[model samples]
Target: MQRGKKKIKEWKLKDEDTRRQFEVKVQQKNNRNRGGWKQLSENVLEAAKEVCGESTGHRRRRRETWWWNEAVQRSLQEKKRAYKRWQRTQNEEYKREYKEKTRQAKREVARAKRLALENWSEELNSSEKQKEMFRIAKQMKRESKDVMGAKYIKDERGVIKINTEEILGRYVTLKTC
Candidate 1:
């Protein structure tokens, strides 16, 4: 279908004739299986594929966690191995090593993710296009759902007013209240 229009191309051959020819071709290909495939329409075929979540790519379902890269995966695998070794041996040395490795792996992953975020933030801050910064800010707002607002209360005059009094809470939490 072409853009800016809603026109379906007419089939050169009729649907019934096309299905009959397709059936004959299938029958010829598979001599043993006399019962050929059922008539397939474009709509039905697309619907089936949609329902089945069909994809040609072998890695179509690969986990798409961007922050979890090869380095993090390697570290995690190493940590797992260390944990297993410690579990099997029950040695103090192995246990200490495993704990150290686990901590290091966690720290490395955190540093990498933090660095990535900082790099992105820096790039957005330095970008000439204002739209990019706004977009990033919008995305951050969406991902960080922490509400920010001062608590409002009805005054003696029966008017809702923002409470400016000091509250026994963290700044972020106070604002949220």
Candidate 2:
């Protein structure tokens, strides 16, 4: 169970000692008081936490921004410093500097993204990267199928035929045609 998203623990049921300790704690709770289902469940969870350990329930994720280099980092840092200076002093010059820095950082980030995409496209055009391109295409196709689920017939005005009678009428017209 999650509590404030700070810690998450699961029962170490595979370990014999953990299982025994959990059982003992649960039994002690059950004997100490005759409580409602909520109390009982809370006790069980407490016992499990004592036996098990907490986890953030996070896995390693791939970084999408492969083109994030030192230049982009420096630009962002400069922008942040300018913004902080402006915030602290509330000076017009500082504010202008912050705005300029923000624009420069945004341009840098956009340029990096464009360059990375171009490089990736170039690599994909090479014969050796054909397999990679096909793999990406297949993955995109699979994702599209998952997103665009259950295609339905639409009328000429582009409204979906929701009623059974309307669907049957459309089917009849199609068969006749």
Candidate 3:
């Protein structure tokens, strides 16, 4: 037996209708095998050129050259310099305002403290009892001494040292006249 089926004979068209049908089938097959629109357009153009003729001088122009202008660059530099100057002025103004605000606050606090001391002095001097109480409080502070981690009474030549414990405790003593 022949190794391969002896190269199958090519089909020959016998009529115009058969030839037209064969061409239609080939075109459909070609369309199915084609890619997207760009590829299809390229294939169609190539086929058109084969059937018709090719055109010339259909090329795109080169793009224009671009460079930075000296004047524009200088203007940009000036704008940046002006911005820095304005920023410096604004920062100085902010610092000045902050200092003035802090100075005002300090002045208010000093005035309030002075007025409070004046009122307290007036209250302390208003009544004789208040004055006596203040004197007694001062005397008590001068005489008190810590003894054995507690305040106690001590006598020196009949002078009594009275503290919290001695003042609060009750005592009884007998005397003959």
Candidate 4:
């Protein structure tokens, strides 16, 4: 039994070593075909040549005039003048439209206020009798019986009274008056 276990352990070790060797060989083959760092360096060199004009078949040229100097001054001044003129015209048009709109709005609000006042005055005059009837109806509805069968009463002089059945419905008026 011990000899059989030793044989088994040796077989496992061989299998592991063979697998590792195969993996290493495959990696080496892939690296060779892909040209890893050498291909990257070649591409970088070609890009540098193109950007620096070494591959364009022409010598590098120098600028004759500086961009921010006298060559651009006249054009810049002309642009500034045109911009100022445009701004003035726009402001004038905006002011005119704003004033007209504000005037129209004011007129509309004043007209609405006048109409509201006229309607209110007409309603007050036309409903005078109706209002008086409603007021009297409301006052009568509010009267109630309380302790000792007493009922609240009011007179034209603004005096109030509480009359009870025990007093034979006789009322004693109190001044508020």
Candidate 5:
């Protein structure tokens, strides 16, 4: 499928008529075929209207997930409302309160997400395949692999063994290889 929106009459013919021989013939043929101007203009207008309709039409629904539940959304909305309220009043107290609420709400959301991941990890710890997947996920979610001190690595000898290291070299190798 095409990446962006398609527009009518957007096919710009080659400028300066590179085909010197066929240019005059093409222009003459185009001029002679002028009877369809009324219908052509109407079609172009219709197309323009269609494009406008798409822009002004009912908004398309977004894909949502159960993970983005009501409580978090409500907290976010409340934070925004607090900020807006501060904006309206320009009161220092309101601004401070908004900042505090925002930090609290954000921390709450992050804590919830971390707790969910921990719960999932606990459940998946039973299976070897799941443990591997969890490890991969942990690696992917980490800000830096430098924090992975004395990490386990699958060696060239195909031995699942522990190897101690200060840093894990780089995540690029882990992702690519």
Candidate 6:
């Protein structure tokens, strides 16, 4: 069975022509297949693919915004409401209110972020939180690294290391040096 069976665009089946095409394809394949369940299953999958498109499985990466809180949400909502009101009326008073709300929202978000970072730093300072500290450090490192950049590990000759063995050798050589 194909891994992305669920990824098939089922909405295409809503169209009558598409449904007819799928049914015809399945019927044509069925007449040729004398084999049991396996052949029928394969024919159905092939029909589905030809009728509806499949997703490539690539998805967008969502960033972790751990600092977001209730205050930020409320401020952002107020800003959005003000902005809509200003857009609807084009009045100077409403525009000014929208600007003020935008600024307030920004301030709240910044404050929340600062507080979160401070809390993380405090946790890192505590001996008991060593495991949590390392986990956070690893997550931060993973987030900060450029996906398209070359590997950071280098040999003693200053050549960038690529392979796992070479990278390990570079680390071992560094410890000795």
For model 3, how does the per-residue alpha-carbon lDDT over 20-50 read when each residue is reduced to its tens digit?
6555654654677678777766664444444
- Position 48, candidate 6: lDDT: 92
Per-residue lDDT tens digits of candidate 6, residues 65-84? 77988999999999999999
lDDT of 4 by residue, 7-61 (tens): 1112222345544654464455555556677775554444333332232222343
In candidate 1, what are the lDDT values of residues 54-173, reduced to their tens digit? 333443334434366678888888999999999999999999999988998999799779877776667665555367678878999898997778476554455665555523233445
Which segments of model 4 are wrong by more than 4 Å? Answer: 1-90, 126-177
Instruction: Choose the strongest candidate by lDDT.
Output: 6
Model 5 TM-score is: 0.36
Which runs of model 6 end up more than 4 angstroms from their true locations?
1-64, 136-177
- List lDDT for all candidates, in order: 0.61, 0.80, 0.50, 0.48, 0.60, 0.85
Could you arrange the candidates by lDDT from highest to lowest? 6, 2, 1, 5, 3, 4
Better model by lDDT, 3 or 6? 6
User: Could you estimate the TM-score for every candidate?
Assistant: 0.39, 0.46, 0.24, 0.22, 0.36, 0.44
Off by over 4 Å in 2: 1-64, 147-177
Query: Tens-digit lDDT track for model 5 on 15-80?
Result: 234234234544554565555778556554454443332232224533433246566788888899
Residue 137 miss distance in model 3 (angstroms): 7.4
Candidate 1 TM-score to native: 0.39
Which run of 10 residues does model 3 get worst, by summed lDDT?
A: 168-177
Ranking by TM-score: 2, 6, 1, 5, 3, 4
> Against the true structure, candidate 1 has what lDDT?
0.61
Model 1 RMSD vs true structure = 16.6
Candidate 2 per-residue lDDT over residues 1-177, each given as its tens digit: 433443434535744787888899999988886799998998888777777755554454333356887889999999999999999999999999999999999999999989988987887877867887888899998988745565567776778998888988887888898
